[model samples]
Target: MNGAQDLGGMMGFGPVVPEPETLRFHADWEKRALAVTLAAGAMGVWNIDTMRHTRESLPPAEYLSASYYEIWAKALANQLLADGLVSREELREGHAQEPPRPVPRVLQAADVAKTLAAGTQYERAAEAPAAFARGATVRTKVFHPTHHTRLPRYARGKRGVVEAVRGVFVFPDTNAHRQGEHPQWLYTVRFTGPELWGEGADPGLTVSIDAWESYLEAA
Candidate 1:
C-alpha cells in the first residue's frame, strides 16, 4: 500500500510549517467533516483501522492534492458506499433514495461527552510470551502488503534494538481486514537515522518506532 501519504523520510516536500496557534480545524466544512466521520463511525460498520486504510487507499494524485479533512470526507463516503448504507446517486443528490439500514448503536447528542471521554482501547490481554525483550536486536521484515499495515515503508528490513515492551495490542493488519484483533506484542524499537535513511543521514540522529511483533524477527 505504498502511496503518496507515506512520505516520512522522503525529500523534496520542503520543511513542515507549523501553525503558531493550534486550531481544531481551518474551515467550517472541516468541522462538519469530522462530525460526520465520528457519527458514521459510531454505527460500528467499520473499525478505526479500516477508516485509516480507506483514506490511505485513495489514488496517489487525489491523496496528494486533497486537504486533511477532505481525505476524511472522501474516506467516509467510500465507507458508507461500500457498506451499502448509501448509493452513488444518493451521494450526488444529497438525499436518501432508499430505506436506511439499521445500525447496532447510534450516537446520541446526550452521550457525546461520555463517548469522547471513554475512547476505544486497542490494548488487549497478552496471549503468549513476548518473542523479544528490551535490548534485543531485531530486524524488520521487508514487506509490501496490499492490505492495511501500520509498518512504514522506510523502516522495512532495517535493524533496530528493542527499547521497551509496550505490551500486547490488537494487530491492525488483521483488524482492518475483519480478520479479528489477532493481538500481538508491541515494542518501541530504536534505530539510528543512517540505518533507515542512507550514509549521508546524521550519525547522531536516532528514531524510535512502536513496531508490532509480526513485523520483526530476531537479528
Candidate 2:
C-alpha cells in the first residue's frame, strides 16, 4: 500500500504521514471496530477504495473544506445508495439489522468481472461525435451537467491543442456505471492557465486533462 509518506513534497496538497505507533493504534482500533461492525451486520461499513480524480479536480471551496476521510466517506455512501444496497431511509437509520444486500444476481461482481474479462459487456454505441482530430486546435465544451462528468471546471471553454490520441475509455458523463464504455478517440488536451483563466492566471503554469471525444469541439 502506497500510504501517506509517498505523497510528500508534491505540487499542491501532500499526504498524511502517520508515525509507526500511530499506524499501529489506528490499525488496532479499526480491527476492533470491524469485528463489532461485522458482528452487528452493519450495512455498508466497509469502505470502498476506488479512484476518484486528482485533487486538482475538486472545486476550490470543496477542496479546502473537506478532509480526506470525509471525501472517502461521501463516496462510499454515494455508491451504496446508487447501487440500491441501502435506501435513503436506511442510510439515516445507520445500523441495519441485516447485512447490506448484495447486488442483483444479474449484476453480481463475479458475473460482471467475467463479462469484462471475456470482453462482452454493456457499452455505449456512439461513434465519432468529436469534430476535431488529434493535433487539431480545439476548445473544450463548457458543459455543466446535472450529474457527474470528467470535464474539469477549470478547463471548460478554454482553447488548447490536442496533445495525444489516446484510445477510448469509460465515459463518466451519464452515470457512475461508466454508462458508455464504447470506444471514442480520446485526447490529452493541454491548456495554459493564462489561456484558461486569462489575466489572473500564472503565465508559466499549464494543466493537462484527459478529455473524451464527446466533451470536445473545434476551437
Candidate 3:
C-alpha cells in the first residue's frame, strides 16, 4: 500500500506551496469529472474505500503524474470496468454497448443536495470496550498489507501517547478489500517528532494521527 500518494515527510518532491483559498476547480472539466465520479459512486457498485484503493493502486508513474480530479476520473473508470457497469469498448467508444445494469440506488438531481449534506455515517456502536485509555503509551505495529490500509508508512513502528478515543468505526484495512467493516477502536495517538523523525528533528514538533486499535499495541 506504500505508494506515491503517501508523501508525508518524503523529501525531494519540493516544499508544498499553498494554493489560493478562492481556487476551487482548476478547469471546467474538473467539475464535471467530480460530478460524474460522485454520481457513479452513488450507484453503489463499490464503497468509498474501494474507490480510494483503485486510485491508490494506479501505477506509481501514472498516479504521480495525475492531478487530483484526474485520479478520481481514472479510478472511476477502473471501477466501472471492473464492476461490469461499463465495457472497455463502451469506454473507448463513449457509448453503451450493453443493457443498463441495475444498481442499489440511483442519485436523482433533486436528491443531490440532501445526499451530500447527510453524508455517509461510518461511526458504529462499539461491540466492546476500547483497548487503550487516554494517556496510555502505545506503539504502532509494523505491517505491510497487500490491501488498502489507513495506517501511513511514516507512523508505523513508532511509539506515541493516546490523546483521545475516537470511537469505533469501519476498519478500512478489511473494509476496503470487501472483507468486512470489522470495525475497531480508533484513537488519537500523539508522537513526538524525535520519536518518528529521529533526534535531529525539531524538538518542539509533534504529530497526532488517528490510529485504529489494530495498528497499536501496549508499549
Candidate 1 lDDT, 1-219, residue by residue in tens: 786778787777667888857676788999999899998899988999889899998998899889989999999999899889999999999999999999889999999999999999999998899999999999999999998898899899999999999999999999998999999999999999999988799999999889999999999
Look at candidate 2 and give me any clashing residue pairs. none
What are the per-residue Cα lDDT tens digits for candidate 3 across 84-189? 8899999999998899988899999999999999999889899999999999999999998878988889999999999999999998888888999999999999
In model 2, which regions exceed 4 Å deviation? 1-64, 87-95, 99-131, 175-182
* Backbone clashes in model 1: 0
Number of clashing pairs per prediction, in order: 0, 0, 0
RMSD per candidate (Å) reads 1.0, 8.5, 1.0
Shift of residue 163 alpha carbon in model 1, Å: 0.6
Q: Is candidate 1 or candidate 2 better by TM-score?
A: 1
Candidate 3, which segments miss by more than 4 Å at Cα?
none
What is candidate 1's CA lDDT for residue 45? 88
Q: TM-scores, in order shown?
A: 0.97, 0.57, 0.97
lDDT at 51, model 3: 89
Candidates 1 and 2 compared by lDDT, better number: 1
